[model samples]
Target: MAFNGKFELESQENFEELMKSLGLSDEVIEKYKDQGKIIEIAQNGNTFQARYNYGSKVITNDLPFGQESEFVSFTGHRVKALAKLEGENKLVITMEGLTAAMELSGDKMIETLTNGVSTVKKIWKRI
Candidate 1:
């Protein structure tokens, strides 16, 4: 599967700004600012399992394309989301107030998260 890999965070943009706009406390934001993050993805057919490792926390989501599923947001809230595959290398997930798109290019995966008010882009390298 194109999305199957263990990726380590390389760099990020607007992460703090987005978190701040989302009402996250400065202490919470600081806690995760320099945290090492890793994402492991396994895709089988149209179904995918994604594991996100953020130093002290690990969140996993089981997603089936075109179906609504329960997903945990970065804010640690459960939300109903629909996952969709765009072409062959991109997976887009839409939740109540957020949209996340993960696109694979070469050995890197670029994840863009938007909450209407702010946007964050994180680049990950396959490890």
Candidate 2:
């Protein structure tokens, strides 16, 4: 779905570079990059999931029985990971941390929460 990489050597430049590679119009990428949330995604697919901080606030997660749905929308779902807001950390899920979190909310979320240390390991492997 997505290749794991960081454009952090130069946040703005690297963001521009990665966005260009992702086929975004220069105008589109510039909007978000200007705000400094470089790695955010507006959409996703079945094989992949994405995470972004919302308003730098936290939310409680809830779940339903077998909470499966054809569409998992989070517009009103303002929950975000503590570190995501700082942008000092980036999470690129290789296995299923991203997968599990998207599936189960509430207490099951951390099981899907990206492993910060493990993620750094994966990033190191790619670099």
Best by lDDT: 1
lDDT of model 1, residue 87:
92
* Total colliding residue pairs, candidate 2: 0
Q: What is the lDDT of candidate 1?
A: 0.88
lDDT of each: 0.88, 0.28
Candidates in order, TM-scores: namely 0.91, 0.27
The residue-by-residue lDDT of candidate 1 on 38-111, one tens digit each, is 88999877788998887778889898989999998655789999999899899999987789999999999999
lDDT per residue (tens digit) for residues 11-110 in model 2: 2124455445545587776554544232222222222223333345322232222323232222232222211111222222222122222221221211
| Deviating ranges (above 4 Å) for candidate 1 | none
The per-prediction CA RMSD against the true structure, in angstroms, equals 1.5, 13.9
Model 2 spans with C-alpha error above 4 angstroms: 1-13, 36-91, 94-127
Model 2, TM vs. native: 0.27
